[model samples]
Target: MGQTSKKRGVGLEHWLVPQWPAPNTVFAYVTTRIGGVSKAPYDSFNLGLHVDDDADAVQHNRAQLSQCLPIDASPQWLTQVHGNCVIDALDDGVVREGDAAYIDKPGLAAAVMTADCLPVFFASKSGARVAVAHAGWRGLLDGVLENTLKRFPDAPQEICVWLGPAIGQCHFEVGGEVRDAFLQASTSKQGVAQAFRPSDTEGKFFADLYQLATLRLKAYGVCSIHGGGYCTYCDEERFYSFRRESRTGRFASVIGLLS
Candidate 1:
């Protein structure tokens, strides 16, 4: 576990927390908009490589994040496509085009990048493995969380989850189609239908992403969960919000095992 603080020079502030009883199993934390070397839009401390930021600057920022982690455990980066596909990080083949990554192997890290999209982290209570998922509305509708839960060998009750910052309900306005998609997927779950409420603007509705995620997790029997209070679109200074800035940079959420 680590601690959160604002460091000068870098221009980025980071949040750190420990996974207590499971001390040996390193969990997840996110990077804020403050530190890094990218200019304008990207500002500082942007870790996204594919976002049109100067490659060299992105590389430098990534290096800074690496320095913060233990020397033995290198962070594993992924090519996210907002799909439910989950791959094993231990495989050294070409980067898989998917939304999630997991690993039971010690010293291997699993990470996902996001702006307003949810970054959900998972760890077995027994400390056997960990995973991270990028859950945008598309991915969520496609069953990303359910797919990731299936990756764990243990029962869903043994899995612990942490839902990272994302667009909150008040700021997450969606069309009727989006709400219908969730209602369709949550067929057996009766209360899911109410997660969407009509927005003040016509033809739009306020979608509670956090509530949807909780419903999905509970459906799968994963009840030990935490986090999911912040809203990226609402807090521009702390996080990068694609909805707020179409050309903005992305932040990262990382988790791995301690060697």
Candidate 2:
């Protein structure tokens, strides 16, 4: 896995720049809960409008984010429903309804907002394609990653992925039924079993979302996986966790090909 770096310039210091070996034309970033205008629980960089933050504040934060990108880049934002829907990103100024956005055209970035849910970044080795997905457990179980890959012009092996921050296993506890659902969804029963460890309570387990996502990617023959080991719940200063705080805001994971 490659180490993710933080932007150093003024007003962009807290943003995360993925350090994977993506082609120079590919640019990917993840926003932290820093450098924005929202207040209190959503304080700072709250990117999700659906989270009940003041609409004006979110737009201000979004505009601030936009200034950090290339001059011609237009980010495609979506109303995420946590399903497997993936759409081709467009700059038509409409907020589309989907969980993932794919872009092959230059200057159009694919973006997804998440608080605790895993945000996955995908790009082709050639850097001609890029995508971002908002993968909560429901979306993962529903094949959101698979659906995103289907939009790529390249094969699974030709794609590289980065697993962004989420509620790590230390804080991501799930019921037996959740574990059973994943087990039922995969043929690699033993592999799937490894992603869950029995929590202190009976009939409960601590799930490893990163591991589960990696398993899913590997099952599809994608080998160049990177960027894991971040804990949104633990890093309160830098991330927002829905499980940690019921009323909170979302950060964004965005990727695009430079024009």
Candidate 3:
């Protein structure tokens, strides 16, 4: 199983895929800074093409990832501007500006980049559809998850979601504006910031992105949410963290139907 180790939140191994009730035909996985050709900083296995890592090295890393895919295809990468735009995974020739990609057809993989931003994976109940979202605070506030969900025919509860590794509340310090944005995103403006607490520094808060996202999904009646609690900032060997180290590489969370 090129998925994950039984000891979930430990060192970086091969892959860090979600293990839940998604249909057997649905394929979803995340990459770590291991098992590839990248050198120091990126270390190894860095798949993002936009980062400053060597293009040849990234190609090599991605080629390694392509070998692990159940299908003989590469993931459809996006320019992810931390916006709400969602596109079809099939639309991947030139890198488009989008935060998410939905793929209904088998063999096409949808992926999003992240060093600290959350990577959200989606799969329809019957495995007819799969998608991946890049959810930085800006994207989440602007409804990237909402946009991605709308691309599928199923309702919120009919889809299964997995929240991948990201900067946790413990280390994710944010300004008041970030909190206000989430409050504005929520219709009720109630308890949306409950996960956010006043930081030791004035006018700052420790925002819980996972809580904020789960709250939004629950509002839309999404129930089968899994994964989270692994902090990228804390897991030095297992993940790359932009907040912790600026010149780091991005990993990916990908999803698609296995052909």
Best candidate (score: lDDT) = 2
Which RMSD values do the candidates have, in order? 3.7, 3.9, 4.3
What is the alpha-carbon lDDT for the whole of candidate 3?
A: 0.83
lDDT of 3 by residue, 39-105 (tens): 8788877877777899999987776766677776677878878889998887345666799998888
Report the backbone clash tally of model 2.
Answer: 0
- State the weakest 10-residue window (summed lDDT) of model 3: 3-12
Query: Higher TM-score: candidate 1 or 2?
Result: 2
> Which candidate leads in TM-score?
2
Each candidate's clash count: 8, 0, 0
- Candidate 2 overall lDDT versus native: 0.89
List candidate 2 segments past 4 Å from native. Answer: 1-10
TM-score of 1: 0.90
lDDT of 2 at 94: 85
**lDDT tens digits, residue span 1-259, model 1:** 3332322323323553533334355645688877778898998778888889998998898767766654344577889988899988853535567899888877677668899999898888888788899999899888999999999997998888888889998899999889877777776546776788899888889888888888889888998888887899998877899999988888888887765
The list of candidate 3 runs beyond 4 A from truth reads 1-13, 91-93
Worst lDDT 10-window in candidate 1: 3-12
For every model shown, what is its TM-score relative to the native structure?
0.90, 0.95, 0.92
Q: Global lDDT of each model?
A: 0.80, 0.89, 0.83
> Total clashes, candidate 3?
0
Runs with alpha carbons beyond 4 Å of true place in candidate 1: 1-13, 16-23, 91-94, 188-190
How do the residues 1-259 of candidate 2 rate in per-residue lDDT, one tens digit apiece? 0222322333477989887878877888899999888998899889989989999999999878877776354589999998999999998878999999999887778689998899999999988999999999999999999999989979898999999999999999999999999999999999999999999899999999999999999998899999999999999999999999999999999898777
